[model samples]
Target: MWPASRIPFQGRGGADFVEFSQVQDPSMSHKVQPLSSLDDLRAVLRALPGPDDTARAAVIAREPTLTKPPRSLGRLEDLALWLAGWQGRHPPTMKTPRAHVFAGNHGVALWGVSAYPPEVTVQMVKNFQNGGAAINQLCIASGVALEVTPIELERPTRPFHQDAAMDEDEVIAAFNAGFTEPLDGVDCLCPGEMGIANTTSAAALSMALYGGPAETWTGPGTGVAGHALDTKIRVVAEGVALHAGAATDSLDLLRRLGGRELAAMAGSVVAARLARVPVVLDGFICCAAAACLKAFAPDALDHCVLGHVSREPGHQALVAKLGFEPLVRMDMALGEASGSTLAVPILRAACQCHAGMATFAEAGVTDRV
Candidate 1:
């Protein structure tokens, strides 16, 4: 979402915790978390199916028709490439899909990067539980198991959530906690998040990773515009600069300036890679977390799928750089993993056609231009 992002940042998972966002101020500091060692970072790179792609090329080569195509289906061929990477071969499998949306409050929302107040996070979690949320309703209609986890990343004003969601060290600890899950059976995993003023958090993480000014990535989030957005950008720039020096590890940066939902989604990304599952990408907030994961585990990039286009400019940059095709262009910014939930049936259809359509010889039809 920022002007650049060649470096790493931290961001979530299923079945463990929820929390609030910790924000940084640009006026505060100059140092940011640096990878402990290049080797430690390299240790996580998966190398991603060896770049030759000879086998996928073979699968398409085996198809009977040669002239009726030159990437004839257009974008469908693009989709084919993503699925092929997931299967480690052609004809990928799409079965037993699950989607998760992580939600949390932001400590910085108190500074007003959003029009809505931070209290909205708790209510939305309740809505998710009651089946009123878009993710809940759509998942119910589609029969995909959807999970929502709200973590209090910031120390709560109330008595309930101190240890519930992740902190700096907590992020890594949560990863270890969820590390045992077997992700092979999960064919689809989509990331979505909830946190008031989280776009500011997203921008800050982008700033840290890219070392760019905050205005470059900041955008209208939840109807904010004009002065409020400018304020959001200015505040984010300050937060990024302020927290830059305090960050000792990736976890420290996230805790000092990230939202709970982003942390949880980060865990999910790491888990999906370890288990070899493909995750559908949602919006700016989620994609920001995905970028964090990409740095932490470059191989995790192999396990991701971009779901839809977000109204947020940040998401668009992430999609372009991450190299994923959006399934729809509907100006949606609802968050909560709703885009991926809706994209499921369409993705399933793609898998169905790729596996079910008969070849020319089998159907007694000649290949034609």
Candidate 2:
């Protein structure tokens, strides 16, 4: 019951890009059971599905037979095994990879938390619709479909420094919006975000979840430096302190400190796990959203990997905290899934090499003594 249409975009030199229609629907899709309260979501999280060990064993057996020496491909071999295990099939394919970018506004942007204004969120979303953003070209090159979901761009969340970013009901609604995103036929999912001052929300969420100093997580988002950066750090500290006692759990912390887009990202991660799709998580804010799941369940993020390490100062530390090694590190900080999209081709290559290579017996190459 996804409400959007799929539009075929013609890229340069006859390349085809699958672009998902950017229509917002508030109702839950019939494909996913609707959540009535936080308890429903908590129950679902507690009972998450795990990877297929059978498929993983198949990869392990086939890898040694390949024409190359053991571990010659390094992480590529690991990536292929991960894909097979999560997809529940040997010789896993990336035939229908997709990226979802969630956009929302933040009330803290009004307090100079970011260099960009909240209105920029709407404008950038429009740019995404028009296929003008960097993510569009990256998706085209990577041959991945693109979907943009704007979560009430006109209604920014309440400033967390002064109060809860979202009430329980509001956060649940946003979480459902992402939880219901259609994953039919998708082999891999790349989740990213686009929102003004969302980095501030991410910083605050991280500080609350990890018990780190606010300065350790806060960084210059949207090119804010000097006093603006100091203000961002102060705001994150105040927001975490205000909500520290009220957050009974990680999900509660997300509701208290996370924006609509962040909550939606968390929901999408859940959706991908339920669908047996491996995920490539984007930069700082996107990873922070996924980290909530890790805090909830120790192995909740077993099927996810960091697509790239952002140039943001806090991202490297967050990645370390999550115990994930990024696939790429280009010093890129532009969100909207730019970093993750760039990784799609790399994953595809990993699968291709694992599936396409012949065994030494077939290749008539003598096995090592």
Candidate 3:
């Protein structure tokens, strides 16, 4: 069952909101006033705590004795240690894994930036609710609970090529929405997003943060090609140009170039890190959120795991710029937490290996010469 404090945000068809309430930290309880501005949001982010160094050291020490040729497990060994560091356990276990899929619509969708219609956003959301989505199937198979949060699904963000996606109050509200639910018992989080043409926003944000031409970050979202692809690239370039000043600061860039779903995901990343829960990142949309989170809270990535490098053209550059090595690279473009859910089983296996594998001494096996 979901925690009691979770609230639903009203959308066109129904409420599309879920949040983790009753966060465990005492510091988190000192209620700050409603976030009215970016500075207010930054202050909340500033109060977030970083990962535990002592716990990371403990995991590093234990890795040498895990009854294998040292580092033979490769990334799994690294993942085990990484998870241990944030979990503050000698051998971390995946006790509870949850996925949050944030869905919204971009006004840019009206500009023909995607091959699919904007209504697909609403339809896919229903698919997720009905357990007919790929992410739903995968989360069930992996024993991970999934929560799909629809942020302003009835109202799409402003066409970013012409104006900012949302006003400051709306942006702040969406950001705060991520922290409204209680996440006390969640061991890890996977953040994903759904919005037709959101790739344009992500690409614009990527260009703003990573300093590249819009074409460099633009991709064929939903399989648009030829002149359609050209339109996407042009729209992103124009959007970035229109918001050049907001690009000067991370929060401002997000305000100008990001959609409601992106901002909510960014807020979720901050909330997860402050709660000391490790985050497993999905593709480009998740990466775009991470980029903003890094700016506002630099240590947030310390609690993150890159689930995969997406088929989106911009994702490769963003992942490289952020210095992440993802666990999967299957060229997945399905943006409903499918990639991250697939990686949850690997994380559980890593935890199981670390906790249950016997040491050489216990196994009575001689060490290699």
**Tens digits of lDDT, candidate 3, 1-369:** 111123222223333332222235855452333467788777776777755788778778777776899888888888888888787667687978888888878898998999999999989887776666787667767777677778778888899889888888878877776655446677788988889988888899888887878889999978999999999999999988888765557888887888888988887777777666788999898898779878667765778988989988898889998889988888898877778878888899888988898878899988888
Better of 2 and 3 by TM-score: 2
Off by over 4 Å in 2: 1-16, 19-30
Clashes of each: 31, 0, 5
Clashing pairs in 3: 19-181, 20-181, 20-182, 21-181, 21-182
- For candidate 2, the per-residue lDDT at 103 reads 84
On lDDT, the leading prediction is 2
Report the lDDT tens digits of candidate 2 across residue range 148-213. Answer: 888887788999999999888888888877888777678889988889999999999888888879
TM-scores for all predictions: 0.75, 0.94, 0.89
lDDT of each: 0.61, 0.86, 0.79
Candidate 1 CA-lDDT value: 0.61
Sorted by lDDT (best first), the order is 2, 3, 1
Question: Of the candidates shown, which would achieve the greatest TM-score relative to the real structure?
Answer: 2
Give a tens-digit lDDT track for model 1, residues 1-369.
001111111112222122111232545422222223323334444443332265367546644343334566565555555665554555766666676666666666766669898888878776766556677666655556666555543342111111112344544433332232234456677767777888877777777766656777888888888888988988777777776766664445555666656766766765665455667888888887777766555556666767788988877766776677788777898888888877877767666666666767677777764
By TM-score, how accurate is candidate 2?
0.94
